[model samples]
Target: MRRHRHAKIVATVGPASSTPDQLRALFLAGVDTFRLNFSHGVQADHAKVHAAIRDLEKEVGRPIGILQDLQGPKIRIGTLQGGRLDLQAGETVRFVLEGADGDKQAIPLHHPEIFDAVVPGQELLIDDGRVRVRVTGPERTSITAEVITGGPISNRKGVNLPGTLLDLSPLTEKDRADLAFGLDLGVDWVALSFVQKPSDVIEARGIIGDRAGIMSKIEKPQALDRIDDIIRLSDAVMVARGDLGVEIPHEDVPARQKELIRACRLAVKPVVVATQMLDSMVNAPAPTRAEASDVATAIYDGADAVMLSAESATGRYPVEAVAMMDRIIRSVEGHKLYHSIIAASEPGEEETPPHAVATATADLAEAVRAAAIVAYTASGTTAARVARKRPAAAILALTPNVATSRRLSLLWGAHSVLTEDVDSYEEMTTKARHHAQDEGFAKPNDIIVVTAGIPFHSAGNTNNIRLMQI
Candidate 1:
């Protein structure tokens, strides 16, 4: 099957549509990637979906990308004993770590991590900011708070700490287990949620052990602050605008999304714009014009992928949402400016070791009108950098790492091949050309760009470039 020219569409799977037949319909409807959210389902359910996707891939004779998103640390309040508590404006309430024992007025606060991070005068928003609490005590476990415009306090409502840097790692024990389970399933990508620093990506990758590509979710303000470092460290990124909108001002989400797309493009890492792209379609058959424009904007901004959350996963119109997203992407790609934006936003050569070589090779590819650019990367970093330029020729990313290969498959204009390590650039180029010709991707006389690091077996040292004639 031929690949789509524009950015790919990633449809999430949920209870509304998790069957094999539904997944096949989504694939046929132009979903290039499937996202499995570990936050909602059990391991067995995810396994079923994985097996179904593989079966469908075999049936369709094309590789499909699977992204497993680990639920990061989700902070929430403890159980409410009185069921629901209400407080008037400017009323003082104590948020204690202990359970509510027949307390009709106050609710218990769980998650001691929050207590450790919160200081006096810090704002705590519960239930998506429906209930606001201001820390007014010694900032200890027994912090005092005055409920500001409190509503019905349900059981275990989520807590959002805006502008407060909690001293907590993004990955929880649940996330660690989920990461392990995802690796066992052999997923192509593992998307870590609420990533704040590059260290989170490193830690997640260490646990994944090169078994899956790390896709960092840029949803928190802290993540935005360290975006460049995170981009350099991650294989892919997602503009997770849902919680981001909640954390930051909603008006700022659009600008942040654009900035994130540009950053990832410059890094040559695949970027996905996700959440509420077609939110209305969750219940309605058609999408609002605003939602349609949002999807188009991501495509025009040169994102490698656009995702559907509740719309395709738990929505009433799963198939229709996927079809609509496909239509929107195609329509946006038809514009002449789409290709121009992609080409113009291409990443320049990094001054770093292998980046310099990859840039030189990319320059030669453009000059020689090469049939393709071939990059040998164990970590998939070099290939990703080459792809950022949005070259006219396709990228044949050769990697011995299976996880890297599968992850690269979802990137724009990238075709991954699994092969053994080559001793030299010459051997790498020869094998690349052979593979290209064998796959009917190149002619014997065509030119090809080859790039690899010196002393090849060493990881993350891509420092060589060559122009070869097939």
Candidate 2:
């Protein structure tokens, strides 16, 4: 199942699309990766869905990527009196650090981290920014704030603290348990939510080790301050515009999304533009024109992938959403300006031999109009490096590790296949030609570019290049 477009699609599996038949339809509809969101489902539910995806993968004869998204700490207000509260603008409300029910005069904020970190002037956004309060007084055990945007709020509504850095771990107890379970189940990637800084990525990596790739989701304004460091530490990045838009200005989300995509491309890491790409499609058979443009805009910005959250997870038209997203990507990539835009945004190469070789592979592939660029990658780094260039030729990634093949499914322009290790130079060329033809990337007499490292099977040492006629 070779995808026609360069960018990949990640669809979340949920109640609407958990069955084997549903998953198989999604995969056939151009969903390159499946996201198992731990935020809503129980472990048993996720296990059954995971098993179905694996079964579908074997049936389709393709390595499909499974991303386990760990729900991070949930910061919310405690129970309220009457289970609800309505306030007007310019009114003062006191939020106390207690578990007792609160009336209109006082609201209970359960998390101690907020009390410790919040200061005067910091805004507390409740229920996804529906009700905003500016902290006017920060006492030892309570905070008094003036309502800037007033609305109805109920028990356990989520709280977003803009411009406040809480000294809290990104991973809660539940996330740790969920991470272990997903790792044991052989997830290819783990998308960590509630990331504030690079340390969060480092912390997740400590537990993950080499078992799975760690994807840092940029959801807080704090993450933007040190985005470079976070991108460097992460194997992939996600522009989680939902929570991020709530924390920052809505107009700023687009700029942040573009910046994140460019940063990820510079780092040679896969980046997925997620959330609300096809929200209207969740109920309707087709997406709004604005939503279609949003997905296309991400493609034009050189994002590695665009994701579907509720649109595929709980949407009524899961298959249609995937097909629509696939069509949008193909249309954008086929646009005449697509190539020039990607080339113009290409980051400067690092001053290293491996990087230089990767750049040359792309350059030669385009110069000779080769059928494909075949990369032998044991750790998938070689494929990522070549993909960063966004070459015209398709990327045929050959790896001895099935995990590498599965992970490469998220990368742009990478058609990963499982293959045996090459012990000699001739063996490498023969395998490249055979796989290129076998994968429909090349035919007899068609030219192809091959890249690998000397003393084969060495990871991260992409030092050789060869041009071959298949």
Candidate 3:
């Protein structure tokens, strides 16, 4: 299916929208990518959803992307006395590394990395910042903190350390198991959560190895310190504002999101602005004005995609959420200021032949008022480079590899089609014209821009550009 908008939509699959029929409805409603959240379901559940997505893709005659989001290490307080405790502000609380059922004197924190990394004066947020405490004393086995913002905290409540840099790998035992399962299932993309360092992406890449695109979720504040390095190592990135907003100041999240999106665009990698966009749609039939603005803001900032988490997964109006997101993107992209804003924010081109050719292709396409920019990509790099320009023309990404086409689903303005490889220059023109008209991107008299490598099938060698009539 061809979408009118450039920015893609990623909708998560959950109990509310797992049925094959429901998935088909969602797809028709405008979901480009389907996310299978490993945090809430078993492998069997995900396998069923994956199968349904593949089935829907076949029925719709389009490439659909499946993203496997691995739940990383979860650090939380252990079991507590009577399963809960209430502490008042100005009271000192002790958190110990080893405890069965803790009382007000000492609360159980099973993760030792927290104790080892935390220092005095660093803030510790519990239960999504409902309860805040500052470290007054940090010892080998226990940490004493004074409650700054007091509230009732129950067992296994999450903890966020904004200042402490813990020596913990983002991938836990469960994440490793999930990763292996997802890879074996032939997922198109794998999203790594709680990425704090570039080494985490490197560690995951050692296993993925060109099988799927590795997306680093920028949720931890520490990640922002070395974000350039992490983005360089990753195939894509997600601006996860859920935990990121909790770790850093709420006022800084918007700026960080803009910066992250800009950085990814500059690096020519796909970036998704995720978490709580259109959150009200989870129960209501329509999104709030603020939520609509939030989604539109990402589009105006030139994000490759905007995502729906709970709004599409376990929400009362999953299909409606997708449809609403589609409407918002289309409206924002059609705005008069959209062209100038995106063009002004566009990153400078890299000094390389592939980049230079891709730039020229976009310039020529826009100058000629071409109906489409057809990119014959073996590894999808050519399309990605062209999409980095965010041209007004539609990107018709043609590839022989099904996996590459599937990965392109997350890219901006890309309408991927699985096609046979072209061996000669004449074959390229024929196929380009055929697909352009077949996909409704161009009419018989419409002009289109074609770009490919010189050797025809060689990957990442995008040095050729042509202007052809459809």
Candidate 4:
């Protein structure tokens, strides 16, 4: 298949379209990737859907990416004492770690660490702000709250504290197990939800061990605060606007989305804009005009992908949603500024540690009319940097880590190849040239651009470049 100017499309699989026929139809409708949300289904269901996708790929003779999303740490209040409780606006309610075991007057707050981080007067929004509480006391297991808005409190309601930094870690035991499962399943990508720090990416990578690519979901405000570090550590990123909209001010989401997409583009990592693009299509056969504009805006902003959550996953018009997204992307891409935006948004040559050297190498590639640019990156940084320029020739990214390889597949105008470790710059260049030739990416007498560092596999150690003939 010919490469697309933008990155790709990731469609979630859900009840409305889980059958083999519907999956195949969606694929034909132009979904480049499929996301299996582990939060909703069991392993068996996912496995079946996976098998069907593989079957469809074989039938069509094209590779399709699969992303398995792990359900990260979800903090919420446990059951209410009485099936439901109504709190008045002026009432001071107590939220405790250990409350009445029965089901009537009290509600149980599960995460004690959250209690530690919350300070006086912090706003805690529950059920997407349908209910609001202002923290008032002691800041311990036993804390006092004044009901900002009265609503019925039920079992397992989600809690969001916008201003307070929760002491709890992003990943829980369940997330670790889910990561392992995704790895074992041989998924192309694993999306880490609620990622708040670089350490979370590192921990997930350690467990995944290169089996699958890691895409950090930027949903929480804390995650946005540390975005640069998280982007550097992760293979790719997902603009999960669902929880993100809930966690931050609604008016800020559009600006934040643009900022995130721009940052990822500059970093040369694939970024997917997700959630509510075609929300109206969840029940209706067609999307709202505003939603269409939203999808087009993401495309024009140079996002690597635009994702559909409930639209293609559980909507009544699953196929239609996929088709509409494909049409919208194509229409947006027709604009001349679309390509220019992508180029102008790329990071400058000065951004890389080995910028001067890599740029010199790239210039040599152009001067000699090289067949491709070969980038040997340990953390995939150099490869991404090369891709940002949108070179005339294909960019070949060779990585020892399979996760990085798969992740790069989503980047624009870049192809990824997994390889054994290379100990030296010379070995890396040689292997890269050989791989380019063997893979039919380059021919004899063709020049190839190669970029790498002296101490291979060291993060941020890139400092060497070369131009060689195949």
Candidate 5:
């Protein structure tokens, strides 16, 4: 089934929607991609879900993308006595870097890098910022801090360092193992978490090679410092706003999200705005008006896909969440200002061949009133560029690699299909014409524009554009 809207939906699968039937229902409900979060599930659990998604893909006769989000260096404070304790405000606490022994006065902080990385006056957030502490420098192998907003501190709650740039690898040992397993399972994308610099992306790319497209998760403030470089190296980027909200001021997320979307749009990389989008649907039957507006705003800002984390992963209304998000997108796209909103992006950037061709594709289609724009690519780059235009007609991306086709499924206005390799330019147009007609995107006398690089199968060589009649 074709989507009525341009933007895509990425639904995460978990215990709430792991069965093949449930996954297929989600697909029918307008989920374009399935994200298997490796943070909570075991390899065996993911293996089952991966197989199920693939099976559903075959049954639907459409390419579906699977993204394995790697859990980065997640720091947590060790347990307190009686498994919990109440620390009042203004209480001084000692956080040790080792041993799981501690009381209300002190606690075992498992991640030593936190002690080595943080300095005096930096804030540490625990339990998702419910408890806050201000550092007072280190004390031997521990760090002393005064609780700024103390409450009930529990065992093994997550910790967040707002501005501390830790000497931590984006791929932890567990992440490496999880990535290897997901790659072996043939996942379409791998999202690297807590990426601090371009080198982190380079390292993940070196290990990943071409096995899977690396999706860098932008959550840390440090990641914001090198977003351009990170976008340059990675295949895609996810604006992970949960931790990002903690790492930076809550009000700054909107501006930063817009900045990231614009940057990715300029580069023609797929960007997903994730974390708590439609989160209230986890238990409720419908989302609040504010949540509805939030989803609409992301689409209005041109995020390729808006993600549903807990809402789809473990929500009681998984299908409703997908359907709701789909409705919100379609409703926004139906607005008269949708196209104009997309047209308001920054326009002073230098143009490349691909950019020129993409801009020309949209203009050419309008000039000829063409049926669609067909892009033949190897890495889906050309199709993504074309999609960045938010063309008036559909964008068909034909690729020989199934993984490329699947990954392209998440792109706005991009309908990915696996096809035979095109060895010559003539074959490219002829095949595109036939597919366009066969796929019902065009009629016998319809005019359509075709774009692809010469020297077939070579990536980033989109120098050829043809306007053809089927």
Candidate 6:
């Protein structure tokens, strides 16, 4: 079934919603994609979910996207003696290379790479920024830091280095293994976590090599600096804010989110605003006011998709979370301001025929109050170009390649459908128009804008546009 809203929803599959019934409920609740978080589940676990999803796809006759999120070099604290330690603000604590029984004064940090790069003035955030530390001394393989924001730091809590760029590869051994499994499963997208540079994208792209789309998870500060290059190399980008909020100041997260979204929009690449969108809904049936607004803000900013992590993975209300986010996105897109905001991000082009035709199709559709902008694409380029214009009408993309149709789901305002390959513009036009009518995008005598590449079945050959009455 087609989603009423333009923005897509990506829901993570986990213990809370891994069954056939649960997964079907999520898909029916408007989840356009299913994320298999490799950090927690094994290949076998995901294989079941993947099979179930394919089964649902067959039942519904819709192309569903699957994203495999690879966990990168994630560092965590060593086991504490009591499993918990309270650090007071301004207290000096020592983190050494050797794992040890940790107390209020000392903790174990076996990752020497962190100590190698940390200096006397840099800050370290422990336990997701709950306990912040300012490095006061660096002696050999140990670091002495005074707590800046103290709290109860639990065993194996994550560490975030805001300023120091650590010497680490984006892909870890575990991530490589996970990537192989996901590619073998034929997942549509593979998201590399903790990306720090463009070379990371190069490395992942090298391994992926057209097997799947590479999505760089932008969470670190270094990734922010090399964002344009990373976006250029990546098939898509994910604004992963869990660890990002830990490194960057909380007050800066909103602005940073907007900046990244804007960059991806200009690049014509799909970006997903992820992490804790409806986190409170993980337990409560209803989302918090701020959380609901947070999701709407992303949609307003023209994010291609808004994601749900724990809210759908281990949450008690997975279906409710998806339905809630779908409602919020639909509501926001219906607002008058949402139209202006997304339209304002229209891309500037060098004025080629394909670009000219794509723009004209959007403009013509709006001028005629057409049912939708129907795009017949092979590589999804023409549809992407049209979607970047953010037309008032829906973007209905018809593709013969199922993979292209699946990947096109990530693009904002592009609702992809799979159909048989056609030969001529007339055939493409007839197919697109009929499909729009069948999909309820138009009725008899209704007008719709149709655009396609001149060389049928060829990539990036869009040069023709026409208005057809259904």
Candidate 3 per-residue C-alpha lDDT over 312-363 given as tens digits, one digit per residue, 9 for 90 to 100 = 9999999999999999999999999999999999987789999999999999
Rank ordering of all candidates by lDDT, starting from the highest = 3, 2, 5, 6, 1, 4
Better of 4 and 5 by TM-score: 5
Q: How accurate is candidate 3 locally (lDDT)?
A: 0.94
For each candidate, how many residue pairs have backbone atoms clashing (under 3 Å)?
2, 0, 0, 4, 0, 1
Q: What is the lDDT of residue 73 in candidate 3?
A: 81
lDDT tens readout by residue for model 6, 1-470? 78898889999999999999999999999999999998897789999999999899999988999999997999898888689888889889988777465865568888888978888888888878878889999877788899898889888888989966888888888898888888988899999999998998998888999888889998998888989999999988999999998888889999999998888877778999999999999999999899989999999888999999999999999999999999999999899888887777655663677877888888899899999999988888889888877787999999889889999878888989999989976788789878998888999999998898877868988788888898
Local error of candidate 1 at 119, Å? 2.5
Q: In candidate 4, list every pair of residues with a backbone clash.
A: 81-103, 81-104, 82-103, 82-104
The lDDT of each candidate is 0.81, 0.94, 0.94, 0.78, 0.89, 0.88
> For residue 145, what is the lDDT in candidate 1?
79
Per-candidate TM-scores read: 0.85, 0.98, 0.98, 0.80, 0.97, 0.96
lDDT of 4 by residue, 1-470 (tens): 43433456789999987899999998888777889998888888988998898788678755667899988887788877665777778788877778556333246787887877888888888887888888888455677888999888778888888856666556688777776677777889889988877888888887776677789999889888889999988878999998889888899999999999888866667888999999999999898899999999887777778898999888889999989888887777777676667556655556545655656666677678888888887666776666556555677777787556656656655666768879966677779879889767789888887887778767545677777877
Question: Quick one: ranking by TM-score, best first?
Answer: 3, 2, 5, 6, 1, 4
Instruction: Quote the positional error of residue 313 for candidate 5 in Å.
Output: 0.9
Candidate 2, residue 198: how far the Cα is off, in Å? 1.6
Task: State, as a TM-score between 0 and 1, how close model 6 is to the true structure.
Answer: 0.96
On the 0 to 100 scale, the lDDT of residue 224 in model 4 is: 81
Question: Which tens-of-lDDT digit does each residue in 1-470 have in candidate 5?
Answer: 56778899999998999998899999999999999999998999999999999999889899999999999888888878988978789988888877647785569897767877877898889998999989886766788889899799888888999877898888889999998899999999999988999999999988899999989999999989888899999889999999999889999999999999999988778999998889899999999999999999999899999999999989999999999999999999889998788888743443787778777887798789899899998989889878877776888889998989999988988988899999987889899998898777899889999999887878978888899998
Clashes of 6: 1
On a 0 to 100 scale, what is the lDDT of residue 104 in model 1? 37
